[model samples]
Target: MSTEKIKAELRTEFGKGAARRIRREHKIPAVVYGHGNEPIHLTLPGHDTMMAIKHGGANALLELDIDGDAQLALTKQVQVDPVRRVLEHVDFVAVKRGEKVTVDVPVVTVGDAAPETLVVTENATVQVEAEATHIPEQFEISVEGAEAGTQFLASQIELPSGTTLLTDAETLVVNVTAAPTAEALEAELEEAEAEAGIEKDEPEAASDEAAEDGDSE
Candidate 1:
C-alpha cells in the first residue's frame, strides 16, 4: 500500500475546548507516539485525512509532514461522532520503513460453495505481522466447490511474502455444512420461540384494542 501524504501542524492547546476549536477550523486533533518517544500532539486536515482513510483501509500508512519534518506513521485508532460520523480524534503510531507491525486484516471470501451447502464465517478478521508500510488491506479465501464437512483453518490461509499470521493456527476460519431444509428451519424457529417463551402476537386482537382506544379518545 502506498503511504498517504498528509500535512500536519504541531498543536500547543489541549483539552475538550481546544479539540472543539480545532474541529471548528476543519481539522482533526491527533497524537503520534511510538518507539519510546514522547507523544506529539498535532492537527491534521479533516477532509484529507478522511479521504485517505476511506480510500485506504484502517491500517493505512500515512506520511505526515509536521512543520516541514516528514515522519512515517500508521493509523492506530480513530474516534468519530456516533451520529454525525465525523472524525473527532485520531491516534497515530510512528513507524520505520521495513519494520514489522501487527495488525488485523479483514477476511474476505470469494467464489461459491457446492450446492446444498452452507458456509459460515467464524472470524471476520485475522491478526498478522507484516512490514509496516506494506500491510495488506484484506485477505481473500476461496470456497469454490467447497463440499460440506470442509473447514478452513487459520493456518491454511495463504499469507503474502514476509507476512506471518499472529492468530492461532487452529482457529476455525470458515465452516461448510449441509444446508438446512425448509422444515428444519421452521423447526428451529419454533424451538427458539419456545425456549424464549415468546409467541406470535394476534394482529386482529391488537387492532380491536387500538380501535377501542381511539373511540375513547
Candidate 2:
C-alpha cells in the first residue's frame, strides 16, 4: 500500500450539530489520536477522502496535510449512515513511517475447488503485523484442484515480505468438503420437517368417496 496525501483542516466545533454542519459542506468529521498525544479534531474533504480510502484497501495509510504540516495516519474506524450511505465520522491513528502496525487483512481464495466440492471460508480475515505504508491489501490462497477434506490453516498462508502473521497457526481459515447430492438435500429437508412436526398433506380418498355418495343421494 502507498501513502495517499489528503488535505485536512482543524475542527473547532463539536457535537452532532457541528458534525452535520461539516457534512453539509461536503466534508467529514474525523479525529487523529496515537503515540500518547492529544487527539486532534479535523475536517477532511469527503469525496477526496472517500476515493483515497477506497483505493487504499481496508486499512488505508494516509498523509494528512493539516494546515501545511504533514502527519501520517492510518484509518482505524469509520462510521457511515446506513440509509444515506454517506460517511458520518472517521477515526485515525497517527503513525510514522517504518512503524509496524497490527491489522486484520482480508483472506481471499483464488480459483475454484475440485468439481462437486463445497468451499467454505471459516475465517475471512487474519491478523498480521506489517509496516504501515506497505500493508498488503489481501492474502490470497489458491484452492484450484483441491480435494475434499483439504483444509487450509493460517499457518499455510504465504506472507508478504516484511509481514508477520499474528493469528494462531492452527486456526482453520478455509475448508473443502464434498457437496451434498440432490437426494441427500431432500432427505435432510424431510428430516428437518419431521423434527418440526410438520406433516405433509396427503389426499383423502375415503373422504372424497363419501362426499360423492352423499351428493348422488
Candidate 3:
C-alpha cells in the first residue's frame, strides 16, 4: 500500500476538445473532490498515472503535488477508451491518512480443489472498509484439498489488520461440486438444446427440392 507521487497541474480548460488536447500531450484530465471541498480540475502525467494504477491496483493511493501543495487522494473512478484501451479520465477523492473508506476488494483464489471437482466463484469482489492509505489490494482464499460439496462464505474470509468486511456474512464466495463426466455433459447439452427448441437443419432435402424447382423453371 505505497502512495505514488504524481505531479499535477491545475487545468482551466473544460469540454471534450480540451480533454482531447490534454491527452494528445501525454497527459490525462482528472478531477479531485471530497471533504466538502470544491472540485479541482487538473492534468496528470498519463504514463506515470497508468503505471501506478497497474502496479497498485484500483485502490491506489496517490500523493498529488499541485503547485507545491501536496494532497493525499484515493483513485475512485477511471474512464477508459474501450477500443483504444487508453485512459480517458480519472476521478480522485481526497482522504486523510487515518480515514476509513469503503471499497470493493477483488477476490482471488489460491491452490486447487479435490480432483474431479469444479470450483465455482459466486462473488468476484467483496466490499470492505479499511484505512484509505492501507487498503488491501485483494483477498486470497485457499481451496487446497477442498472436497466436493464444500462451500465458502464471506464471513469465513480472513481480513487484514484494520480491515473490516462490509459484505454480507452469509454471501457465498466459492463452491466446490463434483464435475460432470463427458457423457453427462453431452446429455446436458442435448437437453438444453431440446428445451430451447433448437433442431438440426434439414438443408440437404431443402437444397434438392430447390434444384428440382429450378430445373422445372
**lDDT, candidates in the order shown:** 0.94, 0.94, 0.94
Candidate 1: give the clashing pairs.
Answer: none
Q: Candidate 2, which segments miss by more than 4 Å at Cα?
A: 191-200, 203-217
Winner on TM-score (1 vs 3): 3
TM-scores, in order shown? 0.87, 0.90, 0.89
Candidate 2 least-lDDT 10 residues: 201-210
Task: Give model 1's clash tally.
Answer: 0
TM for candidate 1 is 0.87
Provide C-alpha RMSD values for all models, in order: 6.1, 2.8, 4.4
**lDDT (10s digit) by residue, model 3, range 1-217:** 9999999999999999999999999899999999999999999999999998778797888999999999998999999989988889999999999999999999988999999999999999999999998899989999999999999999999998999999999999999999999999999998999999999676998989989999999
Q: After superposition, which runs of candidate 3 have C-alpha atoms over 4 Å from their true positions? A: 201-217
By TM-score, how accurate is candidate 3?
0.89
- Shift in Å, residue 86, candidate 2: 1.9
Candidate 2 residue pairs that clash: none
lDDT of 1 by residue, 89-207 (tens): 99999999999999999888899999999999999899999999889998889999999999999998999899999999999999999999999999999999989999877699898
Candidate 1 global lDDT: 0.94
Ranking 1 against 2 by lDDT, winner: 2
| Strongest candidate by lDDT | 2
lDDT of 3 at 141: 91
